[model samples]
Target chain A: AQTIHQWPVAEIKAVGSPLSLGCTIKGKSSPNLYWYWQATGGTLQQLFYSITVGQVESVVQLNLSASRPKDDQFILSTEKLLLSHSGFYLCAWSLDRNYAEQFFGPGTRLTVL
Target chain B: SQWGEENLQALSIQEGEDVTMNCSYKTYTTVVHWYRQDSGRGPALIILIRSNEREKRSGRLRATLDTSSQSSSLSITAAQCEDTAVYFCATGYGNEKITFGAGTKLTIKP
Candidate 1:
């Protein structure tokens, strides 16, 4: 079985503060990683996706960046957080392709004030 | 019906009632994914229908895909209180990213 874990389950940050969130997947090798953001009671928006280590693709630009530094780890970070950046951040993985069914992690709740 | 940019649709029904949510996409896609999202949690896949197939069923859930009409539908039979959640239909092209609908919020009253 595969398990995905996200760090800092919840956070409250001020505007202009730097932020970093991390996700790690276990029991799967070379799985495709993806990042998604969802507003409270709003629809999900895809942020970034990675097919391999060190090669991340941006699906939408929201002043946030994601990197896969290791095969099992993905990091989402920003230099400055904005009020609109506050939302639920989800990390998902699929087997080798974007079209495959994706499994998501527990997710991180962020609040910007 | 639900799609991109539309307001989130809401549906309320009594327990044991059958309900169906519909979604339409604009662009071409090879697969349609149905996901259920609980409060404060990530969306979980419930059913996936491919362009090659018209309908698929799992347990009490049924999913249908109409490639010609560019739409898909998810039906829940004998709904329970625990079945209350927001349902989203996402279209996935073979070579591109997946596009999610605005979602339908369903409330099952016991």
Candidate 2:
């Protein structure tokens, strides 16, 4: 079975600190990976998506970026965090192209204090 | 683009009762995905019903899709307190990316 794994289930950092969250897909190759953020009120927002290695697209700019270094790995990182960055971060993956039922990982909740 | 929109932003029901959630979308889609999100967790795919199909059932949950009107509905039979969660409808218009709508918060009173 294909499973998506995200690390650092929860994080707390002061403003201007660096942030990095990761997602890994097991048992699948070349899957489409996505990063999403849910605000405190639970509004789903798309942040970034990657189709393949070395290519990531930003749907909404937040002074943060994503990188797909390998086929099964996608990373979300920020050099300086803002208070607005605090939220629940989620990583999701879909199968091949058009026929994809997106599967989500556990998720990482970040608190910018 | 709000491709899929769900009605009944919140619902509260007694255990063992049947409840239905409705969703409507603006664009043409080949499939509609239903998701359930527990508090503090990522949304998980509960049901995926395609356009060619009218209705699909999984255990006690049933989902119906109507491509003609760009709408779909999910019904949960014999609800339990564990089923209390936010439900979302996502529309995939042949695009790999699925756009999710604001979810419906369902509370089951056990």
Candidate 3:
């Protein structure tokens, strides 16, 4: 069994402030990691994906960047936050990329004022 | 429909009734995944149907995929109050990125 953990269950920050969120997966090695953002009642938008350590790919330009510092860890950060950045951030892991089903973490709730 | 340039939809039904959610995509896809999200939680994979499979069933949930029509549908039987959540259909066009639908909010009244 694999478990995914996300830090800072919730955060309230001012616009233009710096922000960082972290996720760690246990019991799975070389898993594909992904970051997603969703508005309160809107669709989920993929932000970034990581296939290996030290390598990350951006799916959309939401002014956000992601880094895979370790095989089991992924970080999502931005230099300056925007009001539109307020939403629920989710971390997901999968065994494969193309057709694998992803397991998501508890998620982090961000409020940019 | 919940996918391709459409807004989110809401459906309310009484408990023990059956409900179906639909999604239509514009691009070509090899797989269609169905997910459900509770309030303030991440989406969980409920069912997945491949182009070759056409249709798949698990317990009380049934998923159908029509590659020719570029659409998919998920049906739940004997809906319970705990089934209230948002359902989304996602497609993978044989790529790393998976496109998700706008989602449908289902409310099961007990």
Q: i-RMS values of the candidates, in order?
A: 1.3, 2.2, 0.9
Clashing pairs in 3: none
Q: Scored by CA lDDT, what does every candidate get? A: 0.91, 0.87, 0.92
Model 1 misplaced stretches (Cα beyond 4 Å): B1-3, B94-96
DockQ, every prediction: 0.73, 0.51, 0.78
Candidate 1 local lDDT, B13-96, one digit each (tens): 999999999998887888899999999888999999989999999999999999888889999999999999999998775454
The segments of candidate 2 whose C-alpha lies over 4 angstroms from its true place after superposition are B4-8
- Reference contacts reproduced by model 3: 0.66
Best-fitting candidate, scored by lDDT:
3
Candidate 2 lDDT over residue span A1-113, tens digit each: 89889999999999999999999999998999999998865557778888889999888799999999999999999999999999999999987777467888999999999
lDDT of 1 at B6: 76
Lowest-sum lDDT 10-residue window in model 1 chain B: B1-10
User: Candidate 1's error at B53, in angstroms?
Assistant: 0.8
